[model samples]
Target: MSTSTIVPRAKATGHHILRIRGYSHTKAVVATGEHVVSCGFRVNGRTWRIKCYPNGSTMEHADWISVALIVEPEAAAAAPVNPWFSFSILDVDGKPVPEHTSTSYGIRGFTQPGCNYGWAFHRFVRRFDLESSAHLMNDGFAIRCDIKLMRAPSLRLEETFLDVPEPDLHAHLGLLLDTGEGADVEFKVGGETFAEHRCILAARSPVFKAELSSSTAGTCVKIDDMDATAFRALLRFIYTEALPETTVPAVARQLLAVADRYQVARLRSVCEDKLSGNLDKMTTERNANSPPVRAQPRGHHGTHRWFIIIFWFMELCLKFLNLLGLRRQPPRCSLHHSMMSTSVDKPHDDEARPLISVSTIVVSQRTGHHVLRIEGYARTKMMLANGQYVCSGEFQVGGHTWHLRYYPNGHRPETASYISMHVLSTSIGATEDAVHGKVKLSLPGPGGELVPLCTYHNNHGRCTFTKQDNAISFDRYVARDELEKSSYLKDDCFSVRCDLTVFVKEVRAVSLVEVPPPVLPHHLCQLLSSQERSDVFFKVGRKTFAAHRCVLAARSSVFKAELLGPMREHEASCIRIDDMDADVFRALLHFIYTDEMPTMTSEEATTMAQHLLVAADRYDMERLKLASEDKLCRHLDTTTAATTLALAEQHQCPQLKEAVFAFLCSSTANLRAVVATDGYEHLTSSCPSISKELVAKLAAAL
Candidate 1:
């Protein structure tokens, strides 16, 4: 569809015309607040399409006085030859009035010259702030004017959720305001006092201190004698250190008043920096919803609470500033340095700010979006949005360990908690009680270190413990068996063999030593024993581990020929295995017993990579070698890859070396990723035999 054309006729050469395109008016009482202006009119006309502010000059022209016209649909062709039109004036109630009514239109008088025609309302004197009493005409027709104007206009804000009216009791601890003269006004539970040296007090318990005194009082600003605008700003500062994202210096300067009044120099310093650092931020941003500045407030004492409120406000501001990456590295105020001893002053500048004092903070475990509401003692409220709450603090809840920390923005994150279990049993064959023992329960960290998790002392009930080969065992050590079973043997015994070794702690393994058939009759043996309950245990080396009640055994269903049987039938053959974690070993044990593998962990997967390389050489398990190589290729790191590459080279695993070299070559551009794939020796040495072109590409990239 074609666009429609709409244009206006241009004015002819040098012609002067005054036209009001639209008229809007409001009737308001005169400044006297008594007499109202009725029939207030404005004319509507246009010379060109552009509009300008209204005044008397444009309305008084006689040439266009009656020349204005409004086209009716019936007379659509052209402008009317006779354009003059007039309409009656009406009051606010729309009541029509006589022409000679009391309403006045002219500046001094309503009529024209003594013997002349009537003078129009537009012929009045110069501009005035007051509304004019005029009969406004447009296209020779009268128009109405009754628009309303507000006394004041502004952007409004809602009350913050954290708004509080009184100071918090907890904030009373170590709360002292500097009083100059190397002293502070301190308030304790008993009463208020002035002192230079403050001491710590244990009002709570042995580990926790109830009270702590500052080396020096907090920063200060004088607010009592300041104007309301300054006083109000000071209050805001106490709650939010940095002013709003856009705060004027004039407003920030008031923070000095708050700081001085509350004696919080830190807040005062923050205000000074905010005002000084970005002079143009506030003006350009135009944040009109800022805290209101009281025009006039009675007395300074009643405003005493403003200082503390200002303190928290400043705190919130600092948090916001830090979040926005605008936090300043404030220089030590000269006065503070002068007061401190020579030794203390320098450290103060170099030392990191305390965690609580730092507005920009990181917590562990917390993540995503969250809003924090902090209500200070002074009853001031501050709101922070989009902060991550991480719980770095560690604690034990319900026998589970949890760590708390924060994300960068202050959201909480998921926590990892672990529990410990101890008693285990191994079952072999159809025998009910095969092997029983006490074992420590824990998960190994990345370094293959066992972290003491939880301790579960199992007595009876059957559970399985697995080791090398197809060996399986079970524990039937029931708690009730302690009272019913009796034997001549002083110590109980069970037996099983395991090659794996682990770091040992307080928990002991069950002793599982085999026993010969009893010589005494069964009925007589039971009667001769002093105690009824007897415990069976597993034995490893000289140490004995116990199985309390029932002995549980772990057993595997299938057996296969030893892959390395031809090469080494001797059990004494020794081989070194490095970089393997306990979890992988555990998986191997589980596989031997149940023909099933344990669920893998990331660290275990790494260990599995190492195990694969070792097995490739010792047993020549081609499938295992290929599987380990594939895992290594997928998760190759510099350290592990280096070791794997070396082992592959030593074992003459050409395919493994080729895979490692390709990975190394492909990642050369990523220095860190490549270095992390640690097989530098392979890349420099064995890699050449694999691919010369890849080596060259890697060298060029590197």
Candidate 2:
């Protein structure tokens, strides 16, 4: 019944602020439907911008000033990005003017490309209110846009003690035997008949198969000299591959005989093992109770009875051995003579004893942690009433779905004076099966570092979560007065990070070989650096580089065609590469040799990846091109998204194209910022069809 659960952790978030000077003049010039754009800023590794309409974005709300936050155009074409944001007007002291601030109703999702509008304050502040408010100081004011970007949940692997259920083939077969719905043969043993499937009996015993093949379906086979109970037990074993737990020594002996008669080797062996175990028990008891005798007792009836039992056991053992081809014939001596001879003969001292082998199973535990931060603390308290809680976006850890539940004013009235926080598992059937983990709650320090609040530890115990009781809570997480007076609360916001460690157990068998990591790349890199026996040279932009022709040919098809084909430049001592920088060519050669990209600064890496991608495409180096595309995707910003999209389109990289479009379409502000870039003009001119596609994607999203 055990199953795997994917628990998600809380999403990480980021924020930005935009300041506008000379607000009055800017407003006078930028009428309704017109806006002022802020410089592009980075948040959560993506580009974003803020647009402020002096009046309003549209004529409908011309009396009020409007503000909007946008993501990059390329971001719009991918999966939706939901970010929680708040717009606040800051006074000269840089404190928020509470009355003029607008926290988002909830998370806003930017899901379409070329979308210029996102979460905006359409009637943010009336012109009259702005003119009278002291927050607008000296014809200038600053706007803080606190944004919490919701990142996708990441997967974490954990080793747990929970065992997945094994297959139940025997149970299914047992059920079939009990139902007798498909029974084709009937066995009549001692006037008691048992109905069973001919195929099942045939599959279990070769003698039954031979006997049944000779008879027609619906035929009843008669058995002699066998108890009906033993026959029934035999039929059960044939289907289930196991004897009933309550089987006694008497029944075992009878079953063993019948099993041997029908050629059911495994059943015969099982019955033999059971009977032998009973024999050992009886012999041990008899030895403990009786006095030792030096000679055999010929007249005693008890001795005769024990001798007969031993002889019968030996005879069955001989038959089983003969069936298994281990013995060709049975011994000729009578049981009485054999027992008498064994009693007089000395016991063999060279008999081998059983051997025991010992090995250890290695059990290891893997633990991982996820941090959840709650922003707009003050606002959340005001918005949510008692007993109401807000949940952080779902995150994944150890392949399980989880979320943080924050009760600003406590979860119940009993603890209303305190803030309550709980970590809840959203995994299916979590209540039925418990997940074990620990939690540590903390507040942000002045340096944006974590300051310990309180930890809920089981202290050698597990904090178990199940579907019915899916949460581990700190009801008195923090006193409202203590938090308000503490330095942790600032800017009407506070963050709490939950360090969660899920415990999973893994068992691994000992391995003979301790394999080391591969070093081929390191060796190849050394070879490239040594450059010994180099046969080819390339000149690019006043710099020349040396390389091995075979290595280049092996890594690049274009190089193979140029170096080994009939049109090879045999006379030329060095090849001249055009339209490429010397450094870019050097990097390309390095990749060809080592299959690894050299490290560089973030800015330099982005620029180099673009150049290397083009070179990779030209040389038909798919891996290198894909690596470059992945790098570009991570570094995509408003300024470069349009150009990157054009590059993806031209290079026939569907993945990169999709990523760029997703970024661009994520928010209207993103699209506007990208459009304003010089790259956007180039994109429109070089790939006009892309603009139409963007429009179509946006239309569909709407």
Candidate 3:
């Protein structure tokens, strides 16, 4: 086994590099060309460097710099790993000419003066790999030793070659050009050949590069001398397109303009960045000042721009918001116009443009769905593209369009203007609100179900804002006009005015909605108060606790075991438990129903709520149990509280007791105070541990 070692050469300490005390005269060869030169390098911590001519082409006489090498300790411990090394040769002008190489170098783990050591020389050969072809041009050679002899794995040997191509000045300058269509050109690479096409095409396009005379054309800008390298850089942009970095801002802006005109998106992006950073003020300039406009970049698809790219991002945002049920639909206008003066002397002209307006309707239902209605508008009162007419028929909400058709009887429709002039002028929330109007329909009171607003409708044109609660009202003027405008509106917007200014404290169920004739269970009002019913439940399993009136029809032996009660009667008897959350057991007592358990702890209430849910569920009182479980679940941390409650609620005997203990032990203040304030007060004696905290919190709240 060939042993491997590292030899430290030198350490570059800022300026005066401290050379490794030993191995200063080690020999190295040019890895690129067959030019032999003196070794000038140092390896301090296995780092090695070879100094060479500034030109990097020929190293006939070169001063060596330092390079560092590092070898992994694991690799060193295993055995000597193969250490690949490289060096550089240079020409007299520091340009690469030809290269040389070494077959292999051996390293020993010697500790003293010289550790890394090994060498062999041979004629250099070009690798010409794709990566190399893209970045480097072969001209010379050099050699390096495996610094791994010092046991460093991360050893690197870099050959400093001379005569690297200088940045093309013309290419740098070409980045500033623009097309008449409001686009700019941007530079991607430093070479002249990369951007040639962009330069040539820009000059050739009718939208750019205007011609000028040699004499009186001093005032007119002309392309007198285009740099070949800049043109080449533009060509590169044309072929292997790319964006510009903001380093050369002016050039990048110009190049982007060129790219935009030629539909080179990649180049356009680079220019865009440069413009945003450097010439941002010009972003809003007119298209006539730049290049032919193309579609914006994919990044800007929903973005906004005046000429270059008009991104519909706002519309897209509105769409997303609509989907998420976020924003109210914006006031939509199909006809928008702007008047401009020609040097302040031109007459004002109404530049009306036809467009589409969509209205959104939010419906109250279990499922969240939106209706979009599109309406067309134009001052000309004529259908433009599609058969979109502003007729006198009632506008109905469609999938994504507002369908407006004229009534069968030919009549001049004034509803659209009236909607603009009057309907939109009022705010629905304020006295003058118009966006929304309400019509009061009297409903059932606590004792009686049906009531009518006959008096109120008769007394005032409409009900007071408070009396109309949540009902929709139309603009009386608009309603009347819409009715008159539409032979259809008489049927569509049909309504009979009613007035009931009586001081009725409560609403009754019968007046709520037209109900089918039936002797309902506790009146049809219960179904209407689903929200209230939901809030009254205790949750057990997927459903709510059985209703109080509901009786559990227990099936035999197995059911008794499931109920977990010593006395078969408690299991068998239909228990009329409170319609509260079972988690309430955690804070309050299920047995005490009259007074609110104010002193109960959140933990106790949670336990009580859960037990109540189990009792409600077992007894078939769904509403109470569901409400209890939901409240408990929402208030408590699911992990700690849910696990305990779930187990307690699962079993019967200790289910109530254990759930109560865990909840009482889990001291969350909010749950404690809620039980107190909601009139469940007797919990103070039951849950002594949290009585003080609950009292303080409830007192503070009050």
> lDDT: which candidate is best?
2
lDDT of 2 by residue, 1-702 (tens): 011221111223444456667888888888898887654444444446678898898999999989998876543236667888888887877677788889888778887774364778998888888888787777777777777766653322111111122323345456656755435568889888787765446555778867877735347888888888898788878666778887888998898678779987767667766654454444444345433323333355344444445655665665676678875444443222233334322332322221111112332333555555555677888999888997665555554567788899899999999999888776526223766767778886756578777777677755777767878888899999998898877656676787776665454332212223333344445646765445678889899787655456556668877875577675677999889999999888877655677766556888998999899899998778888887887677887788789889999987678667666656678789999999999999999999999898777534
Total clashes for model 3: 211
Regions more than 4 Å wrong, model 3: 1-64, 75-107, 110-143, 146-236, 239-258, 279-702
- What is candidate 3's TM-score against the reference? 0.18
Q: Model 2 residue 648 lDDT?
A: 90
RMSD of 2: 27.8
RMSD of each predicted structure: 41.0, 27.8, 37.8
For residue 393, give model 2's deviation from the true position in Å: 9.6
Tens digit per residue, CA lDDT, model 3, 1-702: 011122222211101121221121222333322222222232332223223222122253233232323232222244443444543333334333333322234432322232223322322323332114322223322223333233333322211111112322223223322211112223333333121222233322323233221233333233424443344444545322432332365455456455565554445554454433222222223222433323222233213222122222233454576678764443232111112223322333333332211111122111111111112222222432222222221111111111123222122243333321111111123222211222233322223233432222334343333312423222222233443454322222222222112122222211111222222122212322222211123343333432211111111122233343354343232333345444443222222111122234344555565555565555443344444544454344423342333333353323233333334333445245435442234344444544564355445423
lDDT of 1 by residue, 1-702 (tens): 001111111111111122222233311211211111111011111111111122432433321111111222112222212222222233333333354122222222212222112223332222231124343333111222211111121221111011112312112111211211223223321232333211111111111111222334342322234555554343333322333445666676666665665555555555655543342232223223422222222236224224324443554464576578764553242221122333321323444332111111121121121111111211210132223222221222211122222222222112111111112121122122223323322323334344433232256522233332221211111121331242211122211111111111232211111222321122212211211222233233343332211101111111112211244222422222344444443343333222222345444676676674564345333444555565665455556656666666667766566555544543434335655453654555665553454456467534
lDDT of each: 0.31, 0.68, 0.30
